[model samples]
Every structure is written in C-alpha cells, then in structure tokens.
Target: MPYAPSTVNQEQSRANEGPEAVRAAVGRARDAAPAWDALGHRERGARLLRWRRVMARRMDEIVALLESEAGKVRADALVELAAAFEHLGWAARHAGPVLRRRTVRSGPLMFHQRSTVEYRPYGVVGVIGPWNYPVHTPLGSVSYALAAGNAVVLKPSEHTPGTGRWLAETFAEAVPDMPVLGVVTGDGGTGAALCGAGVDKVAFTGSPGTGARVLAACAPSLTPVLLELGGKDALVVAGDADVEAAVEAALWGGCANAGQSCAGIERVYVAEGVYERFLDRITLRAPEITGGPGGDYGRMTVPAQLDVVRRHIDDALARGARAVVGGPGSVVPPYVTGPVVLADVPEDADAVREETFGPVLVVNRVRDAEEGVARANASAYGLGGAVFARRGGVRLAREMRTGMVSVNDALAFTAVGALPFGGRGRSGFGRIHGADGLREFAAPQAVTRRRFAPPLAIQTFARGPRDLARFERLLRRRGY
Candidate 1:
C-alpha cells in the first residue's frame, strides 16, 4: 500500500489503496450496476438520501479529516462540505423527475410518429477527483451518478485518500448490501488503472496536463469522459461597479481555499474609472488575509504547488509588474502563501494567462467594461468569471465567454445547484451540476412509436420511386 501523508504534517499519513484495489472496486461496481439501476430512480434516490443522512450525521468527523488531510480551514471545509451535502440532496430530490421519460416534439415529417427521449444511467462511472476539494468535487459527480442509478468507482486524489475513504465508508454504512459507491485511493498509477478498467464513463477533475493523460488512457477503450479541469478565471470590475463590493469579493474569491479553487478569481480586470480605487483597496486589504494554522485560510494543500505560486509572482515582478501586498518572500518556507496582489502585469504573464492556484491576484487596468470583458475573454480558459457593476453587469457577464459568470459577486454560481459547472478551452469540457450534470453520466435513449400508417411508405422498401417523388414534392411544398 502507498501512503497519503498530510500536507500540514507529513508524519500523519494513511495507507492508500492500490491499483488492485481500484480493479476490485470496479468489479464490485460492475456486479452491483444491474440491480442498482433496476431499483428505478425513486428507490435509488431514496438510498442516496440515506447516504446523505449518514454524511450529515458524521459531518464533523469528515470536516476534521478534511482539515488535517487537505489543509483546509474549518470554515472553508464546512462550506465545501455543506455545498456538496446540499447538492446531494438536490440530486436525490430531483433525479426522478429530471431523468424521467418525457414526450418530445415530432416535426411535420414525423407527424404520424410519437417521439420520446429519456436518460439512462451508464452501468458504472469512474470518477478521478482532485485533492483540493476531495469531498465536494468528487461527490458532485458521485452523488449524481448514484442518483441516476449507476454504481460508482471513485479514485480520489492520492493526497486526500482519508477523505475519500470517509466518503466510501459512510456510504457503505448507509447501504451495506450493495456496493453502489466504491472507492480506490492511490497515486497516478492507480488513477490510470481506474480509467482503463472498462467503466461506463469517467468523470475527472484536475489539471489540463493530467486530463490529457486521462483522455489517452480512456481512448483505447473508447470510454467516454467528462473533465472539469481547472481555470484561470477572471474578476471584471466595471466603472459603475461598487468598488467596496468588488474589492471584498476579490479578496475572498482570490484568497479563499488558498486559491486552490478551479473557478477562483486568479486575475482582476477593472475599468479605468475605478481601476485605481479597486487597486488601492484590494492592495491594503490583501496582506490582512493571511494563510497558516488557524488563519483566514489554511496551508497550501500540495507543497509542490508552492513553487508554481512563487514562480508566477516572481515572473510578473521580473517582467515590470509591481506587487501590492506580497512578493517573492510571500511564499513561506513550508506550505503557506498569504495573499499576493500584483498590478501592471503583462497580458502574457503566467499569472494572467495560466492558473496560479494560490493566494494571489493580478489586478490590471482596462479601458472600460468593454475592454475588461475582452481582456477577460482573451485567456484560453473560460470556466468562470465575475462581473461587478451596478448597471451593465448582466450584459457584460453574458458577453464574457465563460461557462458560469457571477454578477455583482464572486463564485456565487458555485453555491447554486441549478447551475451547470464546466468550461471551454484548457478549462476542459462537460458539465457536472444541475440537469446537465445528472445527464453527463447517462445516455439519452430516444424512442419513436408509429402512431398510424404514413401517407407514403418512403421509409420501407415497399415505397416506389413515385412515393419518394411525392415525399420530395411534399417536403419542397412545405419548404422543409
């Protein structure tokens, strides 16, 4: 067995399940899929609700594990846990209706046919989760897959196997008879094994480089994948925006989670009018939000990522950028980088173009909201963005090329269950929330029933050329 040591304390570690463990989990999931699906949406949902109850009853225990393993603050861990728990409730409460069969419109050509489409769960879904949000992110896919009546084999990030084990154990306690939710915990090799284990689908959350490897692993099997890769999300501040609110949102959104969030605010684009004010306010407030034990945020969960944070800040500084609050010295010896705010950073700088998953923010001045939107959309990432404005926030948000945009706030879309979360470009594709998330692990099976005999037997060999001609003439007459 491999080991998953705590980022906060390396001595504290848990024995990790290996690739063999992943294969066994998948085997169990394969065995359980049929009966699990046969239970129907209502019953599966009921079982999921039971699992949710189990999680709720043991919330404090999970939160403590999250704190020690993932280096997440108590409050941050609670919010993450709450969001995931509530999302599970939403999936269970709505799965039946959302995945239920429903009539679809039949066009004029198919007027004599009755059409319907419904979602059917893939037998088993393999989920590869990131450590930053071991509970919430994995559950986002796992809960939906279970609610849709599919068994799941989860391979949580190796750094947080304890949290993953907690999820799998508690779920087993909820429904001990069938292994509807199976877990495998290990490093990269274990995840690769899960990807190629012949699961019905693979839902992954991680960096783009790793996502590509996952895609490659699933390619030979022709297994479908849903990726929620991280993003270099932006926070756009309009001239008419409330500077106070924008600054506050930036401070929280940029520094929260030690900036490990995929949709966190990595950069800020402010219209020229309020650029100075926003910059001044955010700079003065950035240093106040520190990261350490029992601080505003917790330590960096992954110690290796500390280099990336320092690199982005140093790169920007060396390239004529100025630091408002922190600089090269900000990233402390071990695993803590407070808040580092940079201004006048070049457009091509890594801090602006790439994902610096740390407590850092890049605030740049734009000509106006139009320019802000353009600048924000110029990046290869389009996972999420924020628009802070009194008047035209919604309009600018619509124009911004991202999957989810928050108006007048930051990451508000994250807390909303109805919103589908994912993005374009390097941010990866596929949604994992709301109707789309439930549908991601399932395939749409459409049925068409013949209502009566058609005017022309064009679909069958019985139809002659004259019948085809008649059909063509009818189609042309109707301009279809």
Candidate 2:
C-alpha cells in the first residue's frame, strides 16, 4: 500500500517536517553540535535525568500509543517502555566514565610521557527506527547519542509514527529550550534524505534490504552507519533437559512482540530424546492464543507483513508439514494474527529458512546437542540464540555463532544492562548496551603529555648514535 501523504498529520508528527523541514532540522543540529558537545558530561547527564523522570511519569501514555500503533499488548508495550527507561538511566549514569579520558602507561623509554584516550562526540547523529518495539530500539540510539553529546535527528518507522511523536513531545517537556533532539516523519524518502543529510553518523534499525539502502546512501559522503538488521535466530534443546522449561522459554521467545523482535526465536532444533515432549507442551499452549483489541496476540503492524506470514505457512504445508496449533487460513478478530506452532517441518521449508516475523515457531528433531548446534548455526542471521543443555548450557551458549545467547531463559540478555547487545554476519555489526553503546556515538582521541624531555631525545631530528645503541639493547632484552 502506498503511504498517502494527506493522511499524515503534521501536528501529530511535528511542526515543519517536510523535506525542507528535515534539512532545516539537520542544519540546526549541526549548528548546535559544538555547544552541546562543549557541555561536560555532567551537564549533559542532567538533561537525560529529566527525560528519565518524564518517561517514568508518563509511561502509561507511552505504552498506550505503542499498543495502538504497533498492535502489541498492554503488558508487552510496558515491557518495551520500561526497558527504554532503564537504558536511558544506564546511558546517563555511565556515559561520563565510559567517555572520560583514561591514562595508559607508556613503556620504558617513553615512560616519562603520559598517554590517554578521550572520546569525542560526533557532531550530529541521524536515527532511523523501526515499527517493532519502536520505543525500546530507538531509545538505544537516542539515549546514547544524547548522553555522548551528539545532536539527534530521529526518523521513526512510518507504521508507528505516533509513538515517535509521543516520545519527541515527552522529551520536549523536559528540555524546553534546546531543540537538540528533533523528530522527522515520512516514508522511505525521508529516511534516505536523513542518511544523506551530512550528519556525522547514522544509526538504523530495520530489515536487511532497507539497511543496504541506508549504507548505499551514506557511501558517497563517506558517512559512518550502525545497522541493526534482521535475524533468523535459533534455539537448541539438548537431551536430558527440562522439557517444560524449554517449551515455555521457546514460546515467549518466539511469540513475544508477535515475533517481530530482531532477537525473537524463529527456529528450534530439539534433541531426539525430548523432541516429542517439547512439541506436546508447545502445541497445548499455542492454540490458546488470541489476537485482537485487548487480545493476547496482535495483527502484524505492517499490512504487508501478513502476506509474508501467510506465504511461509503455505510453503510449509505444501511440503507436508503438520500444524500442531494453527492452519494456513487461520485468523482472529481485530489486530491479532493468532499463534501458530508447526511440528515435523522439513528443515528446508521457507518457514524454517526465512524470518517469519509473526507468531510462528518451527520445531525439528536432531540427533544430539552437537547436531542441534549445527542446525542452529545454519542461518544467514546470528543475532540471538538460546540453548537448554543441562550439563553444558554455558558451553553451548558460547558455541552459538550469534552475539547473544540465553542459557535457561529467553531474551534475558537484553535486561542485563551490562551485556553488549549486537549480532554477527547478516544480523549486522556493531553493538549497543553496556560500555560499547557509550562508545558507539563517540570518537576516540588519543592524548599524550610529555612531563619532561627524555635524556636521549630519540624522537627529535638530532637523535645520536647512542640512542640507536640503547634501542637495540632494549629490543634484544625483549627477545625481539
């Protein structure tokens, strides 16, 4: 469906947000960058603290908008909102230390000099957010960017534009004078414009195809980008594991956010010993799901996504797969897509191979833990995975070719606050959360101060023969 520009309400989005407005916003941010960066970390953190308080007070409003736009449940929407607050708090408290200069010891001959590295904020950051978990994902970039002293131009997903508006309005309440952070709303064109808007960097969260486009637009200007793309994450259940626990973990991991999460579990390889048991439990729980207004499940946010879900189901059924919960034509009232559990699915089916960002979970049996791990790793995405091995859960988690792995729980790494969240290969590169997130928006500057000139003065143009002899002796002592 084409996005009708007339339906876009400027008041609901923001005043002055057309192409010309976006250019102006970028210009304003660029002009404000030096002043914002000049504010030491402590001063910048005060603004973030005010924003955090605003988020806490108005969380219900945020959650309601999230549900209406993204078609998520109230509880799930709150989960997203709460995580955003926590992330903001973490960024505010830690950005100072993480970005502060730290002295590094200079060895021997250069010992008289003190070396340190300081992190400098990028001039301006362009953010492109997605519809799924709109607040949580975008705040990861926005909070870090702000804490690191970069002005931000955020372009939220077209599907959930209202949520973005709400966030921008809330922040405005806290920071009234400085338009340091501004929001732009539109279809892909606006995003393309932002990518080429001459911002120092761009942070985008979306599908692989769109991620590619964002990168291509940045190439001409040599602009840097952080792309958090798609994932076909897998779950491995080893033999002798707690079958019930594994099934529950898989259900939440696969169906949470209607399976729209980049880290949502899409595939499962179960060891032969517990395959049937796990399937039975998941089948029992899956059908009880309902989607609609005030329902457990919600319709896919993007209308085009429904077709993708249907196609994956059709491909599996045509290949002789049995649906333990929902069939191809299954539907519910309102916004719910309903939950689906497919068992005995062929490994090669589209449902197993591609990312069905819907309430669908595929289960296949494997010979052993090694086989399960092998099957889980056989994907183009390595964003997040899960393992339910009794004896070697940590070991198995370490072996998964993804950035994050939950041993007994599902998607718990995101809550840890200290663990870095990112992915490998097709899931995209770079990280958010923990110390890495603070560094993402800042550039490193190495500093060195010479307390006194060395007696030999080897760095000068007047280096003598005695310095060369001393350097050779040092290298020989170090076994070089």
Candidate 3:
C-alpha cells in the first residue's frame, strides 16, 4: 500500500490501495460496461446530472479533502472543484448531441449507398490521473467518459488517493445501480496494471516521462491511449499592453494554485519598453503573496517538487539571471516556495527550457511582441500560452505554436467548456473537456446500406468488357 505524504500529523500515514486493487476495479468496470453503455446518451446524461448535484452538495467536503490529500489551499480547492463541476455539467448536457449518429452523404461515386457515421462506447475506459488539481484533472476524463456511455476505472495519483476515492464514492450516491465509476489508488504499479487490464482505451494525465512509461505499458495489448501531459507554458507581455492587467494576469496565472497548473504560466516575455515597469509591480506584489498552510496560495503538493523548483531557480541565477522578488533561500524548509520572480533569464537556461511547475516565474525582456511570440514558440512543450496586446493580440497569439492561447487574458481557454484541451509535441496528444473529449472515449462507427441497385453493376465479377465500356462511357458522360 502507498500513502499520502502529510504536512500535518506526521506520525500517522494513510495507506492507499495496492496494484491488485486496480486490476479488480478494472474487472468490475468491464463487467458493468454493457449496462452502462445501454443507458444511451440522454439517460446517461440525466444520471450524470444527478451525480453533479451530489457533488455540488458535498463541495465543502471535497474542498477539505483537497486541503488534506493534495495540500491545496481552500481558495484553490474551490476553484478546482468548480472547474470539475463545469466539465461534468457540460459533458452531461452535451454528450447526447455530440455522440449521436449522424447522416453522411456517400457522394456521386457511391450514389447507390446510404451512409451514416455514429459513435459507440468503447465499453471500458481506463483513466490514469494526476495529483495537481486532483478533482478537476481526473474528473475531466471520468465525467466525459461516463457521459459518452463507458464504464471507467480510474487510477488516481497515490498522493491524492483519498480525494479520488471521494469522487468515486460520491458519484455512487447519484448512481447506485452499478460501479459506473471506480477508483484504484496506489503508485505507478497500480497505474501500470490499469493500462494492461484489457481496457478498450486509456486516458492518462501526467508528465511526459510518466506518460511514456504508460505508453510502453499499454503497447503489448495495443490499447488506444489518450495522453494529456505537462507543459512549460509562456506569457507574452506587449509594450502597448495594459500594464496593470498584464501584472494581474501574470500574478494570478503564474502564482495561483502554487503555479502547479500544467497549463499555467511558467515564463514571461515582456517588451523592452515596459519590462522595468512590469518587474517593479511584480517585485513588490510577490512578497505580499504568502503561502504554506495560511496564505494566498497553497504549499507544494509534492515534497520532491521542492528540489525541482530550487534547481530551476538556482540554474537561472547561475546563468546570470537576477531575482527581483525572491533570491536564494527562497525554498522554505519543508514544502514551500515561490511567487519567486527571476528577471533576465537566458532563453536556453534550464528554467526557460524545462517545466519548473512551481510558483516561480522567469521574466525576460524582448525587443517587442513579435520576439516574445517567437521566444514563446521555441519551447519543446506547447500546451498553453497567453499574449497581451492592444493592436494585434490575436495575430500574435495565432503566431505561437501552443495548442491553446489566450489574448488579453490568462489561461482563459480552460474556463470555456467547449474548447478542447490538449497540446502538441512533448505536451502530449488527445484532449479532454469538449465535444472532442466526449468522442475520445468512443469509437467511430460507419454504417453503409445499399439504397438501390446500380445500372452499371460494376462491382460484380460476372461483368464483361461490355459492362466496363458501358461504365466508362457513363463516367465520361458524368465528366469524370
């Protein structure tokens, strides 16, 4: 059994489920798959809405869970639950229309056939989730997969197993018929078991390194996988941008949730003209934003993450970057660090190239928005980014290579339930939280029915050269 690392009650540790737990959970999910799929979209959606109501009534309980299991602040916990609620509601309400069968024209070449395309549940879906934003991240896959009529067995991060179990149990209250959603909790072994447990599809969210491992685990079975991995997102501050708005965007986008958000702002590219002004506001503002169990943001969720953040900030400093907000001794003893802001970080430095995944922000001065856009696109990770500009914000945003970009705002793409959320390159592939998300768990099924007999009869082997000549002449008549 694995246990969550605790900030309090250090003497007591909570034991999590083992690898066998995941295998059994997947077996139960597979068994319930048929009944779950037969519910159809409308009925499934209704049941999901009921689950949403149950989740809403237990929001406070969920918030407390986040604080304990994930070391999340109450404020950030609420935000996480709220986003999860949004995705659940959207999936419940829209799965019907999004996954229903659709008529498709066969075109003139196949005029005799009536064609249609539809989506069918893949039966059992295995979801491997992350610890950051524990509720919101896993629910993105669980809710959507459920709404699309698939029974799901989730292997949530061992760090936040209790929180993940709460979601599964509460969902049961809304839908008690069968185990529509099941949770398996442990370390990587449990997750690996789920990937090879004969699931039709697997949706995983985590680092590229872990994602690669998950990919390799599922390779023997050739199970279809959907990966929502990490990101080193960037923020571009234009010279003509509203300085105050940009500052707020950077502060909230970069530091909120302890900067643990996968799509959150990790780096900033500010235009030379207003670089000092932006830095001035940030330097003064950051020291005021406190953390560690009683402040603006939450403490570091994972203790090991502290080392990564320290290493990045230290590397940036060693590379000649200056910290206007927090310098050395920034990483608190046990589990706390950032809203640290480093200025003039080199483009190729570790802090710039890698995903620090802490509240630290690397701000570098650029010639203009164009250069900022170019620098932002240079990262190996292209999950999400933001640009602030008055004249050409959209154009600049479009120029970046990220999957999602916010113009004159910060991480706005996540708030909109309709937009697909995923990325390219090292950030991983596939999506969650949109029409695309609903379909990701379901397989496309195309149906063809012969509507009439064709005059040419070209498909028959009995046809001779006369039949071929006749078909050729008809094709010529049709301007083929």
Candidate 4:
C-alpha cells in the first residue's frame, strides 16, 4: 500500500508484514522485560530521562514527520510533541514515588499484622495507537509502562508507521542495551497478533468498534486491556458565559487537527439566553479558519473518513440543519474539508450522536444550564468536554458526565501532566496519564506480616474449643 504526505506530492509504501513479524517483536519484548525491570525505578527513570533528551533534540524532525504522515499543521504538531514530552518527563520524575511500596493500616482486628502494597511490572505491554496524535497518544502509555518497568511493543496506525519507528529508534539510541521498546509496522491484523501474542497487557487508543475487536483478540489469554476510544464530546455554554471566549474555544477545539481529535468538540449546547450571540461570534471567526497544506488546518489523514464526514454534513443539512459557515460545497475533494458549523441540528442526527471525525461543529440551543448539561450527558459517550461559565463553571462542570471537563476553557485538562485522562461508556475504560496511568501498567502486590503471634493461635489445630471461643469474643467486640 502506498502512503503519501498531506501534500500528496510524495508517496511511500510499506508492506504489512503480518503476524509472524508481530510475534517475533513480542518475543523480543518478553525476553527484554526481565533485564529492563531489573534496572529498578531509579535506573529506569534515568534511562527515560535520557530518552527525553533525545526526543528534545529531535523534536523538529518528529514534528515534520507528524505533519507529513498525520496531515497536522505545524502548530498542532508542535502541541502534540510538547504534550508527549511533558508526559515522558512527568512519568520519569514521578514513577518512583507513585509506584513505590506504601504501608497501610492493618486495622483493629489485625493490629498485630503489618500490611504494605507495591506496584510491579506486567512484563511486556502491547500498545496500539491511533494516527491522530500518534506520538503523544502512544507515548502516554509507552512512557508510563517503561517507567513502571515493563518493556513495550507498539503497533502504530498504518497511517503513521514511520513515526512509531522513529520513536523506537530514538529510544534505542538513548539506551542501547536491551530492547526496552520495540516497533512492529503493519495494519490492523498485526495489531491483533500483538494482542494475542501473550503480552502481559494491552493499551489501545482508537474507535469503540475497533476497541471491541481488540477486546475479543485478548480474550483467550484473559489479558487485561486499557482502552481509550472515540468521543462525541460536547461543549456547554452557560447563559452567563463569555460568548466571545466560548466562540474562540469552539473554533480551535472543533477545527484543530482538522477535527480528527477523539476529544474534539463535536456538539455545542448553548443556553437560549446567549445562543444567538454565541452563533454571531462564531460566524465572524469561522471565516478565518482554512484547510490545506500550510493552512490553519490540514487535510483528513485517513481518506475513508472523508465519506463519513460528508455523510454527517449532508444528513444534517437534509434534516433542516442550516450551515452558518461551511456546507456540503466546502469539501475540497480527496481529503481537505474546512470547518462546518450547523445550527438547529436534531439531537438524533448523526452529526450530533456519532463521532463526526472532521472539522465540523453542531450547535443546539438549550433552555437553561440544566438543559445544557442534560443534553450533553444524553449520549453513549462520556469522554472529554468543556463548560464555559463565569459564575457556575465548577458547578456545571460537576454535573457533566465526562471523565475530564475544562471550565471556561477547551482541551486545557490534557495539558496538565498530573490529571488522569480517560472516559466512560462507549468512550472506553481505563486511564493513561498521571498516577493512575502509571499504576495501570503495573500489578499491585500486597504483603502482610505478623508483628507478633497472637495469644490465641487461630491457625494451629492444637488450639481447640478455648481458642475458637476467644476468636468469637474478639469478633463480637469489634462488631464484625
């Protein structure tokens, strides 16, 4: 299969090597896991820090590759690179404290016992990452997995195999001994092979439908999986919100990355009191956004997705939704499609219900903040969202059902390294950031020890009726 950069002028191709290559890579990862884990947290962290330095030195090259392969604008590519860098650094710096053994109370019933919990590696991890935010998305899992002392085998999207290979190469440059990270380039079949290759666990980022297939692939081994799937994320604009700021956010959040982001704003629910004003502001700003090479946004990375985008727009328009900016005619063939803003779109319309992975936004007026929150939550997805309100931002945010919500801002929660990122319902389960992400790649092992033997020996068969009576008395006193 041939692959081309966003410009479509230059094309390159790679054959899908199938299952054999995937198994070989996974075997190497399995062999390397023990030595990598044996390095301990400090040495592992130091190696990761060196990897970060290498990434820093190669940021420009990585960004260029992202733009060519993922159809991302320079600014957007830089943003993705920066986020990946932050996650890598944060994972290295905080892994020791987050995964270290910690003492827990033994409780009154077992006062003589001491208990502790430690996080241990899961051997090897299989990461199946998406094309959009390819570097950042996979690294979020890979970095944390490495910091937690697990070897990683990554199968990046077919649209971005080069980016994946670059990452593995740079990692090798930093730590030459042992294959701490491995890359297997192929299509979906290779990804499936990795899932069933007996990797300790799998971390997948893609659509919910694909996520289900991945789940099935890992079923026989009962391998645990962490899924970060698609989202039809909503943006709620309260009556008291700053209409201008909200519109600005809608423009960037909805159109950035050519709207391929899983957490990108797909639907906007504005309180009726400020609906017209919000629309006016967005209309004024929408004209400035463009899509092409070296434009505000780039072409759709995946060619098949263009049909889905077109169908969503056409369906909404035929159903009486009016476009305030781009309409059906804005599609520039092959891949490029500018931002489209639709008003009065039905809640059941595909544009609102399904994830329209394109530069499109659907706006619906709500009766009040209560109605806005209700409309936003009335979806199968509960991923990321935004609530723009001055006085009630936090209150309204708490009412939303998504995993992460930015108050008075869009996509801000993802920039901070400490916050956990994931979703519920069809948006998928598990997390891949912060302390929770580090623990996701690890298995928690609990240890308990007796400080001193109890006077009544419950374990010994020698103790008969008197020992049983004493144990019962202790239970009764503790109200167990």
Q: For each candidate, what TM-score against the reference? A: 0.95, 0.95, 0.95, 0.96
**Residues 243-329, model 1: lDDT tens digits:** 999999998888888889999999999999999999888878777788887688898889889999999988999999999888888
Q: Which candidate has the highest TM-score of all? A: 4
lDDT of 3 at 300: 84
Which scores higher on lDDT, 1 or 2? 1
Tens digit of per-residue lDDT, candidate 2, span 128-153? 99999889999899999999999999
* Predicted structure 2: lDDT: 0.83
lDDT of 4 by residue, 271-368 (tens): 99999999988888887888986588888898888889889999999999999998888787655457899999998899999999898999989998
* C-alpha RMSD of each candidate structure in angstroms: 3.1, 3.1, 3.2, 2.9
Better of 2 and 4 by lDDT: 4
Task: Name the TM-score of candidate 2.
Answer: 0.95
lDDT score at residue 180, model 1, on the 0-100 scale: 83
252-367 per-residue lDDT for model 3 (tens digits): 88888888999999899999999999999888878888778588887788989889989998899899999888765778954555588999899888999999888889999999
**Candidate 2, residue 62: how far the Cα is off, in Å:** 1.7
Candidate lDDT values, in order:
0.88, 0.83, 0.86, 0.89
